[model samples]
Target: MLISFAMRRILLPVLITTGLAALLMAAACSTAPQPLEKKSEPTFDEGEYGGEPLPGTEQVTIVEPSPGGDRFALIRRRTPGEPSDPRFQLWIVDRDGSNPRLISVNTHDVAWHPSGDRAVVTVAIGIDFYVYTIDLETMETTQWTGKESQRLSFPVVSMAGWFRDGHRLLVFANQKAYQQPFPRGLYVIDTRDSMTTGPLVKLFSTTCLGNQDRYTVGKKYVRSDDPSSGNFARYDFDDESWRWITDFPKDSLRFVQKPVPSPTSDLIIQARETGNAKQLFLMNHRGKDVRQITEFGGDIPVWSSDGSYVTFRRDVHRGEGARYVPFKFNLKTRKAEPLWPVSPDSVPDFPDLSTQTLDKLKPRR
Candidate 1:
């Protein structure tokens, strides 16, 4: 308190210099490089699995061969733009890849009738979560859902598939999509009714239906990730009960997809992630008997009507871009071939499937 003028001046500069040095040191440390921290996956996607959507080409094309295997119902992007449009235009192409006819726009999913002439389509554009049946022969569209467009009957609803009776269509409703408790799962809607409103019965409760869910058989349904982890389970219509097919280990069940039931109704064929390769496997309806069918990469596994073969989609890169082209795999012969070729019609319609499609695939010997 009684310091001299020279002593005070010298001490003040020293204090100021020290404060500046400390601040510089902290700044240098803040800018120094640190190890990168891996971002953690959310619990929903971390331990729990199943219901992984097919990447890339899922936004471009989805080809569903008619039950008769003589025609293909294709939901293809009208144009591969910069952002990649979510809306798809449904087209019908012959088994030989001829006669490509544009069916509908804003088509989310299409489940064909057993006769292959008709399809139940889901239009999920904007407020239009409407499901309808389209007649290919007449090019006529009839709205099945959303008769009372003023309100939503269910928060989450999509056409699963047409039942064997043809008059009934299976619809999947899950409130879990809105982060709400699931009060609905699978139900039946009679196209026999003009408005498709009443008499809709709730079959059971399944919360994990990924976006653009695909359902084929009512007796067999796939699950999305839930509390423990997502495992493929079969729903028994006979017993009106849920049966867990938890034979496989939890990790192996990750990314299991397209559990298409075999024509015999015993074995289920699906594609799953194996190491780095996406391969095919056959499992029992109860989720046992997991046998590896192919070591090559395949996705969207579709079993033939007779169950002798599987048609799948695999990524193919042209000089222009990457495409998920269709390919056929013979189970008995253990051979893989291109399912269909891109038609080079002067017009996009009236396409053709050629053997050269395999050139892009380069099937393994």
Candidate 2:
């Protein structure tokens, strides 16, 4: 029995050691499968409703917010399923309680010009571009016809301030500026000479090396994709130079919206993150200061006229999963509060609007 016990101990140790060695060899020989490559596609943005109006104050969509002045545009889809065309009508509302007025009776993809003198609008049916100029004093509408091309999905003109001469208009179309799918270049057009009857001339194309397609217009500068840091850049179309404007982290940079250039052109605001952890960055082109005005978790950040405030949509995290909540961020206080009283269940989409024309949208039905 003593001999048997001694033999058993010796055999067990040898067997365990042998088994472990074999397992190690097998693991070393096996190869791990590589992870699948990811698809890079822009996610749809969430929607942010405006603040509560005064007692008996009509509900309006806040378009842009500044220190004391805010511009809001109300848009209503033509009665859904109604006999009338299934298009969105436009209206403009002043921050001060003023009745909304019509801008485009039938138009989508509205783009404002750099001079703030007119808006480039594309109607349903025809792909031609039409300019809608509003008289600030009398509120009269003047329509100008622009050059025809396969119009961009979301086209924007350089703001009045961004141009060196204050007269040139830069239009960016989603028609392959550098590569296919995304906008690759910008077409400069001189609208000051247009009489709405003759053929419009095409200006030189603005090009960027990397997917630097998405951008917003400013005075003598176009704030676009830095692509290097996944942040924003202010491009000088005339001098053919680029300057980095914002310093959003790479992770947050992925979620920033296709920046909305303000009327002044120097300032821009965009969504810089996604889901229930979204944030908005107010950036200045001349200075390197980036302020995080809103920490609301959502997407889409649009700046106001005065560049003091911004409106954006955020998400509300519910532990395991998350829900989207709209919000507004004040730049001065750095307060990011929920804008919506009741959250929206449906996924939101914040379409691009021309600041000049946005003031003219009707409410959605």
Best by TM-score: 1
lDDT of 1 by residue, 99-212 (tens): 676667677777787677899877765544566787777766766544434122533556767666677776665334444333345666677764243223243333212111
lDDT of 2: 0.38
Model 1 residue 122 CA deviation in Å = 2.0
Off by over 4 Å in 1: 1-60, 81-86, 126-128, 149-152, 176-182, 194-229, 247-254, 317-321, 341-365
lDDT of 2 by residue, 282-360 (tens): 4443433444444334355555444344555543442333344435554444455654343233212323333234344
Q: Count backbone overlaps in model 1.
A: 1
* Candidate 2, superposed: residue stretches over 4 Å from native: 1-62, 65-71, 74-85, 96-98, 105-168, 176-184, 195-232, 243-255, 261-267, 275-278, 283-292, 313-328, 336-365
Listed per model in order, the count of residue pairs whose N, CA or C atoms clash below 3 Å is 1, 36
Best by lDDT: 1
